[model samples]
Target: MANPVELTILIEKIKAKTAVVGVIGLGYVGLPLAVEFCKAGFRCIGFDIDEKKVNLLKEGKSYIKHIDEARIKTSLPLFTPTSDFSRLTEADCIIICVPTPLGRHHEPDLSYVLNTTRTIAQYISKGKLVVLESTTYPGTTDEEMKPILEAGGSGGLRAGEDFYLAFSPEREDPNNKDFSTSTIPKVVGGLTPQCLLAAQTLYDYIVVRTIPVSSTKVAEATKLLENIYRAVNIALVNELKVLFDKMGIDIWEVIEAAKTKPFGYQPFYPGPGLGGHCIPIDPFYLEWKAREYEVSTKFINLAGEVNTSMPQYVIQKTIDALSENGKSIKGAKVLILGMSYKKDLDDTRESPSLKLFDILQKKGAVVDYNDPYLPEMPKTRKYSFKKTSVALTAENLSSYDCVLISTDHSAYDPVFIASNSRLVVDTRNLIKDSHKYKGKIIKA
Candidate 1:
């Protein structure tokens, strides 16, 4: 058992010296966290079960493009990746940033979290701090997680004495240029004051603000609230998008006009649908938990439904645009502009672009995608077309009757792409030649 004085000195040591920080699951959130710790002058161990990722780190190669190559090449000595759980003994603080994807029924599937906890539990020891950065239910850490870790040890965790536990939801916006992982404020909560103190101290080293919560549930709930807010607002605009599409009015114009209000309105744009990690997945965690309490989350559930219908709507629009050109979707060569979830990101998890592909294929359109980052869309429920063709050139693009721009990738050479293509269906408002289809460009 550690006294308050001892823990205080320990925290001071963490802030002063190069503490060994272990970041498990080297995906988007974990990779950035490891780099942030290394940049903060802490030695970091980026642990992942995937041997390929571990081997890449060993060779100083980075798979994710958003992460700087210089960081991997130059920062190799401070950064390391390992699959061995025994190496976790060297860590002063450990953070779990693995995926918490939804199940088939859209329920919060905690298999990743539970399996990660099981692995971490095997290496359980005294004095090391643990924090869950995965977005999931509020009671995950204190309720489900605690018992699992306790089962691995000889003695049980006495809240703050034997081991420390906390939940600090990662607000990792993958492609956002403005806010970095260090600049974004973090919300942290622990099982007890000591756990909170230790977790807050560690995050404060790399992040701009450490907003301490009273309990782990608050920290967990805070993440869901942020995502749910986005989901609801996006659904509202998506609702308007469909409405305006039917009324022959542009939703983008209405949004621009509304943004003139200084205080009342904050802008949220409607897209093909919700994409990326948090907004599409995190709200479902809250919804799943609400069910355990025998409650219904009507607004949130309905928002997900509305946002999900967007891809079909886009597909219908594409068919209409092509038909207007005296072309049919069946056996028509259709080119999709982007495959990644959003603009500038390589991450395709829960991307609406994939759904659009499925819908297009279902309508008998010969679907092929062109993305600079992702050469092809991987195998999914409907499409197995993950092969990159020639770069988006006029000759290749001109052959297709219509080009549906799903993601606004930064690499798009817009002027050239527009010139070669017969008709462009811009779902993301990428091409601002907003004059709808001079028989050339259609804004879906």
Candidate 2:
């Protein structure tokens, strides 16, 4: 068990802003968090297994689009980025912000989280506070992480006694200008009361507000519930989109009207499909975990099925648009607008745009993409397109048989695209509903 004196000393360090904050896996979640701690007058150390990321950060460069390089350069004196794990002993607070992606069969792959915990246990000392910011299924922090960390450490150090442990899921919305890391309300849950207090005290200094829950399991479930709610709601709208289209009803106009009611409704817009790191993947983690307890997640599975079918639905729309002008899908020139999953961001993880590109290529269409954020197509596990981004100009747009609007990047001129393209299959409803481009627009 940890000595009470040791716990008190750690709390004093945190309150005084004298604690060294160590953040592991400095990607989307960790980089912003390290910056927030540094901005709050704490000396921060960032750890990542990627040598390229470490080297870049060492030179005071920012790789993420939303994070400013000036912030990283100015905070260099207080922040140190490295790949070494031996420095783990120096930090008073250590937070794990690694990725917990789904595997081939959509199972929760905890390799990154477990490997990082094992490494931390080797050098973790008594009275140190550890918090997990990675999203996963319930019981992960208590059941999986607690066991690995305890077995790897020595000196009979136990969680909540010899050391403190907590779970605080990351709620990072990339490219969102309104709410930042410091502005977003944080949720924290711990193994014990002391553990909760230690974790909450550390975050109170960084975020605007911190909400403490009952246990780590609740914290884990909280994140899953948030994403699952979005997934099911988005799936509901996506299914309605197809049905409304067949009934000769415009879903966008319907949404605009329904939102005016101002009661018993929260509007969620339909897209080509669900994108981003959270909505498309997080729900499946709960679905996979629920199976272990002999339970079924029918809503999650159905949402997955509905959202996954949107790419093909879009392809059929493209084919229909081409056929209207006496053009066949085979050997047709198609230009995909935007490649990133969301608007104004460079992240393309699990993007529906890539799936659309793959299906278009396999169906014998000549496909090209243009995104101001992404100048070149990145290589993924299933795709290795060496194609570079095409320029979005009147002359370039006129050459394609159909222009497909996948991602509604703000930089794209929807009016200009609709005017120049032979036909516009608007998946995002970017084109204005006016008579100028009446015949040219086809909403997917």
Which predicted model would earn the best lDDT? 2
| Model 1: lowest-lDDT 10 consecutive positions | 381-390
Residues 1-444 of candidate 2 have per-residue lDDT tens digits of 456887899899999999999999999999999999999999999999999999999898998988999999988999999999899988999999998887888888899999999999998778899999999999999999888778766756799988899999999998788999999999999999989989999999999999999999999999999999988988888999999999988899999999999699999888888777788889889998898999998879999999888998999988987998899999999999988899999988888899999999999999999999888998875578898999999999999999999999999887789889989998888886634776779888
lDDT (CA) per prediction: 0.85, 0.91
Cα lDDT over the full model 1:
0.85
User: What local lDDT score does residue 159 receive in model 2, on the 0 to 100 scale?
Assistant: 93
lDDT digits (tens) for residues 245-265 of candidate 1: 889988888998999999989
Segments of candidate 2 deviating more than 4 angstroms: none
Task: List clashing residue pairs in candidate 1.
Answer: none
Could you estimate the TM-score for every candidate?
Answer: 0.95, 0.97
> What TM-score does candidate 2 reach?
0.97
